[model samples]
Target: MPSVHFAPIFQRHLPVQSLEPQGRDLSECLYALFQTYPSLKHYLLDDQNRIRQHVAVFINNQALKSRTNWNIPLNDNDQIYIMQALSGG
Candidate 1:
């Protein structure tokens, strides 16, 4: 089982908590997360199912390269973190 964690900022819109879901990759993990919290789907992805510009996903500290290919394999102990991409002037 892999663990999924959302940044503190997301607590404003939904419950702030961590989840351990069974997923071979990011896509499966997200699907399971959305199933548990449907509202998150809109916040995380756009109409094309692409990751929202302001959002970033990292698997074990490595950012995902392809939004379309969420099939990036994961280990049983892997940790996935989701957070807002920061921008500054």
Candidate 2:
């Protein structure tokens, strides 16, 4: 199974630590993430089942165009990343 690891941006809140999820695909991996932090869906996915504007998902250093698209497929060693877009002054 592949592992999805969250970045340190999550440390903005000390109580919530980083997450590592195991699954074979994007959906399953995200499901594992949701299981760990149920409230995370509201921050990432929207009502239409799409990733929110501020949310970003990447696999092998490439951005995902759709949450339910074919581009998100994962393999045994895939490393998925989920993060919010970074903005600076």
Question: lDDT tens digits, residues 1-89, model 1?
Answer: 89888898888656866789778877888998889888899999999999998999998999988777788888989999999999989
How far in Å is the alpha carbon of 71 misplaced in model 1?
Answer: 0.6
Model 2 off-target regions past 4 Å? Answer: 12-18, 87-89
Give the per-residue Cα lDDT of candidate 2 at 27: 79
Candidate 2 per-residue lDDT over residues 12-82, each given as its tens digit: 43234435567666877777777777677667788976778777888878888776563356787776677
- Whose lDDT is greatest here? 1
What local lDDT does model 1 show for residue 14? Answer: 63
**What's the lDDT for residue 4 in model 2?**
62
